[model samples]
Target: PDRIEILLGVGSMTVPRSSVEKVEMASPEQNRAIRNQWKTRYLLHEDYVPAGMENIARLLTAARDARDTARQAGSAHAADMKHESSLLARLERLRSELIRVSKRMQNASRTSSPAAYNAMVLEYNNLYAAYTVGIHELAEFRAKHPAPSDRFSFYLDSLDALRRAYESALVLPDSGQDADRARFLDRVARIIEDYSRDFSTTAVRSEHSESGIIVAVTVNDSTTGRFLLDTGAAVMTLTEQFARRLNLDTSSLPAIDIVLADGAQASARAVILPSVQVGSARCEHVEAAVIAQQPAPDIDGLLGMSFLRNFAFRIDPSSGQVTLTQFAPR
Candidate 1:
């Protein structure tokens, strides 16, 4: 059995092991008990034990008053301490800013120079042109050895070709060249090769049934459930209700100058479709039509170039399935 001592009450009482009792404190003891209400209320404790907030505020106000009185009394010491506190705060901020800038300078020194960004952009543009040429070359290669079923593997092969070309162009030594030298060029080329290999293509659609370069797509209108798969449209558009279901605002979008397939132009706008699935691919920020009533047949939605731009797409008539191969990055 452990010895039990009263916490709130000063006097001690003992009882049977299994029993518990309610005890009341005497008035004098109660008054003494209130001073020890909190553990930190002990004077030697390290934590801040504020005497009522209002009282602390008054003390702070008195400190300010004392400072002011010290100034009036021509005491330089008190004035100097207040000045020093403000000066130290400013110096601390300045020191922090200097440290931050020094870190940035160190990082910038380690990474790229100012000319490096421009050099990268230039290299990227050159690689883009090279990729376009590679696309044509790859098409010729695929015609010589055509296996459209294994498009991913085909893309990887094309990527390997591009990498071989890029690696052949490398004059950079492993440990000898600067970090942003021709090694940077190798990285950009490899990135392009990698990007071209994995991108997906969109399926094209036409009205009622499928036609050349056109696939079948379904669209449901709120007023009329009927949908027309329109190939004549350069961009796919959704009805106002469909747009709402896609959680898009019909208004407040940037107006797009859309040139139609008929060479006639229409003023349209960009709308983002978050959840539209294109052949099992989940796409975000899918740009759809905000404007309606085109020169050609009005479609609930038509597959657009923005989708096609991601892929090297060819509609195979022999197989009814529109084969969307991976992107060629042309």
Candidate 2:
């Protein structure tokens, strides 16, 4: 037979030899080493970034490695290490403030009156201009000092920080009311367009029906189903049939009391799913409940606050489109 046989713990299986792609054999020690390397390899997006940005990222990585090496070598670099720590602390504070400002701008856009929105826009524009000037100054300093020095790491860190700040600024809601502001944003978008794949905003289409707004949800990246967009639900819920399809062991899970939409009380199993995704937005370790029956015949479950809380989302009445943005806290 032109097939390969595999021995399982309690059974045997066979697969067509032609279906096999490739295989590798390694000792346990070698396998563990390879896995460790993979685990430590962060920021994989740098590989695909533009060459100039990639070079900057590599320089930052090298600076980090040098800092680590200096730390391991003991007391000789103590003063320089203290200065590095100070610069990093300042950078972190700047990043936190920028995130807070971005969140404020988003909130104002969504909920504020026209006058208030315009006021916030003016404030944000001023802050943006100030940060831009600071970034230019940092670049000028870096250009003047081409050779590596004690302050070189700070320069690279500041540039990276400003780049992230620009990304955050881009996510701010723009009503296009101000021509100057719109032009500034467009220029910033062009500068960072290549690096903004994981942009903070994502849009997912919804279906409007008698059962309410419905959106497609993916569980554990394995199963997908239409779920009613239920902001009132404290946790996501799955019908017993859907849970079974996901191979969730409801019998072994703990039971919890739930209040139904019809004002009836029922007991259901509680479970935490590995992940739940709506469009490009994904959240991990989401709490979900498994009920005995579906809420609606067409819907498999409810897309509850458990998943929605992780984002700032709005459903447009005219288009039935849901816009989700990463929620940054003030």
TM-score of predicted model 2? 0.42
Worst 10 residues of 2 by lDDT: 42-51
TM of each candidate vs. truth: 0.32, 0.42
- For 18-72, candidate 2 gives per-residue lDDT tens digits of 9878755667887667544443342233222221244344544554454444334
Q: Which stretches of candidate 2 lie over 4 Å from their true place?
A: 1-199, 327-330
Instruction: Give the least accurate 10-residue stretch of model 1, judged by summed lDDT.
Output: 218-227
Candidates in order have lDDT scores of 0.43, 0.62
Candidate 1 local accuracy as lDDT? 0.43
Specify the highest-TM-score model's number. Answer: 2
- RMSD versus native structure for model 2: 29.5
The prediction achieving the highest lDDT against the true structure is 2
lDDT of 2 at 56: 40
